[model samples]
Target: MPHLVILYTSQLDGETDMSALCRHLADTMLTLRDEAGKAVFPTGGVRVLAYPAAHGATTDGSGDHAFCYLNLRMARGRSADVHRRTGEALVAAARAHFAPLLAGRAIGLTLQVDEGAEVFDGKFGNLHPLFTPP
Candidate 1:
């Protein structure tokens, strides 16, 4: 399971479209594959969402800066290398997506990958079949 969440400051709202960025990120993740060429993340399990921060400040408490934080959460069991590669890919995607917004402003971009409990519970249905081959 992979869930991608993008958190950005409201300052960039008029400069960029967060919803479209989230879709681009999700599509990028879906294109990633393991060494064997198999999809690294399940197509049906990919989820991306964006949230605009109402109020935020920089390290010096300056409200003039903007920030974009990406959080990728997935089930545990993948190797460290896998995690690193995935993070790199996603961060690159984020950087490219926000390039225009970063041209003239001080924007802080960061990516975090969280490996959650492997024993978590969930129920998924028809979505799986859509991605499965006959």
Candidate 2:
């Protein structure tokens, strides 16, 4: 199977709710199915992990590095387009929820795939990608 990681960074902290944000992203992931017409979650085919910015990770309006990170898992046969679409969906979600605070800041969203030895070795592991943009 292929694994996906989505990293989003924001500029505001006090106004954000990380738990709700995680739920929203999780729900969104559940709504996406593969070409085989299978539900991604609860079938062992999809998994999502969300992370909110750590307390004191940033300060001041200009120093805030508030972020939400999501990791997704899917079958290896999935295409990059599918991953891209998923990333776009996350961006849209962010825009709807945090546009005002993120506006004019260094907000970013990125999606990536992981196909490691374990992935091809018919075993699942606990590896996830990290936010890479500075």
Name the best candidate (by lDDT). Answer: 1
Off by over 4 Å in 2: 1-13, 41-47, 52-75, 104-115, 119-134
TM-score list, all predictions = 0.88, 0.54
| Model 2, backbone clash pairs (residues 3+ apart or across chains), number | 0
Worst 10 residues of 2 by lDDT: 125-134
Q: What's the lDDT for candidate 1?
A: 0.85
| TM-score of candidate 1 relative to the true fold | 0.88
Writing each residue's lDDT as its tens digit, candidate 1 over 1-134 gives 69998888887788888888888889988988777787889998999988898877777865488888889998887778788889998888888888887788888998999998767576667887898889
C-alpha lDDT of residue 20 in model 1: 82
47-78 per-residue lDDT for model 2 (tens digits):
45444444434345575455555555554555
Give lDDT per model, in order: 0.85, 0.52
